[model samples]
Target: MSINYLVLVAYLVVTFLVCGIPFGKIIARARGVDIQKVGSGNIGTTNVAREIGKGAAALTLLLDAGKGALATGLALWFFPAFITGGVSVAPHGDAAGLEGLVTLAAICGHIFSPFLHFHGGKGIAVGVGTLLGFAWPVGLMELAIFLVIAVASKRVSAGSVTVAAILGPVFALIYGPNLGLDLLLELAGLVVVWAHRSNIKKLINGQEKEFSFHKRGDKPEPDDDTIGESK
Candidate 1:
């Protein structure tokens, strides 16, 4: 009925479509198979990288990040900014407690995309983008932590889990208590860690695979396609 209500509803719908439908279609058509059927049975970019080539996986990653950014942007636009005193500020709407509703909607859309029969990615990048949209400081902190872990472990899951753990209290502190953002982060962190449970087991067993981005001793030059195939 009210402008805020209409905008809030539109925001949720748009985020779901952006994070769920488009991402599912991209994974399906880009790789000629639904990502849900691939490694780990999850549609996240990490699984995409393992199943499809790096190129397609990169595309999915970018798209996922874009959806989070788009959702937060829409939420901000809908909430509007008003000048209070000498500074411009976001005026709380009736849905003030729904601060990160757009972020959650986007993440949920990615985690259980309708297009993928309610199965999708583990929500690492989507969460990163959501935090980035909410607060750049916390987002950068999480990003730095992820990069450090990824480099050390060479495991995307390791980095993702670590980042999620770091985000919970970080966002809570930044946004203050009594805000809805902490609840969303807490739930999202749980989901992300739960999704990586298998990876954690593998890590404990020391059987976890590492990403290979190096030249092997037997690898041939780029021009030697014939030899490369045999190698």
Candidate 2:
């Protein structure tokens, strides 16, 4: 058996399990409540953040992101030749590009993980981390966009959706084709956008809740009508 085949297999196995098992367990344990039961009913970091608090939420975010990076990094470490292919007639033929593919696989596993019954988070943190591992410049851009939108709208959903949208073409333009990283990034972006459709509707109707970073214990404000009617 060629080392290349082993490397590819390792990438697949690592990426799939990282998002599917460890993430689910960590998130579930941290919240002390089944993440699938709350908020958006998906066991992703966002719901966990809203339910648990910042510390746990941040942990979830970092773990989710880290796993993507870890999976890619491991593949690089274990199967250098397989990933790089080292100056071959075939295209892409490099460790960096192979690492990107691992990143994408991890993102997909995070978003639409089969172990979670196809229910998963929006993939913002994981996607960003994956990009950061594979392409640092693109990752920085993603963070910038996320921060800009998050501040401007005061909604985490808004920022997450925007970052996902930018990932597609940005990677393509940066790395170009033959690597297939762009297509993977685009697909991951699409999944994230789809996941946030409910949030999009809420934003359009002016019903989306803004995040309060400073007030850790603050809850979302009640509807104005309820308050006015009470008065």
Candidate 3:
């Protein structure tokens, strides 16, 4: 293998490590709690906000999203060097294809983090970060969709699944004619949907918990234990 190929391999390894950092765990520890033993036993923003506080949740969101953005940014910064090697793995000049691979890798690393014993967040925040890295327009569109749905429905899962379900078509429409890139995005979407299978069941059964901005003094719901456990 050429030096460029070696560089590509190294880039992917670094991306995984960056994306796998358990920001939720770190933030929870700072708050004197173990995220894994808290609300929903999840390390995502929703659970953090519920079990810890909004400040910590916001910080976790930023850090988790940063992982994906940093991974994609690094790939974009270094991928050009590999392209000069005359490699035909991805179509010539198809930067979107390279971005798609990097995005998928980051998402997978976040969802199945090695640092967390192969458990991690649901990938929504990281997905947004990756999409932003791929193209700011796409990322903004997705974020808008997520916010509107989440706010209107008061259900994070509803917004999350809806966005994941449509990412493939939206991506294809925005950047079409790139079969490899489209397929990678579609596969990533599928993985995200699969990760939310439990949420889907709850949605069907009307047992899914809705997000609340204000803390409630009432007892936690029975389903709280499993609400964000999919991560």
Model 1 over residues 49-163: C-alpha lDDT tens digits?
6656567667777878877876775566545542123322122233334546676787778776776566667788887887676566777888888989999989887898888
Q: Model 3, 1-231: lDDT tens per residue?
A: 988768877777778778888899898898677878766776788877877777888999999888888777767666766677454333224556677777788888888888987888888999889887756677788889999999998889889898888887777676556777778777877777877888789889998778853154533222345534448
State model 1's lDDT: 0.64
C-alpha displacement of 196 in model 2, angstroms?
1.7
Instruction: Please provide the root mean square deviation of candidate 1 (C-alpha atoms, Å).
Output: 8.0
Which candidate order results from sorting by lDDT in descending order? 3, 2, 1
Counting clashing residue pairs in each candidate, in order, gives 1, 1, 0
**Candidate 2, residues 1-231: lDDT per residue as tens digits?**
677677577768668767654464366566456655544555566556665566767777788888776765566456655444353312144334555567667766776766766556667777787777656778888888899999998898899888887776776666556445566667678777877787787888999877743135554222232111100
Badly placed stretches (over 4 Å) of model 2 are: 1-3, 22-25, 28-31, 83-97, 173-179, 213-231
Clashing pairs in 1: 44-121
Candidate 3, lDDT over the whole model: 0.77
Residue 161's lDDT within candidate 3 is: 90
Ten-residue region with minimum lDDT total, candidate 3: 214-223
- TM-score (all chains, Cα) for each model: 0.75, 0.78, 0.89
Q: Candidate 3: RMSD over Cα atoms? A: 3.0
Could you tell me which residue pairs clash in candidate 2?
A: 84-94
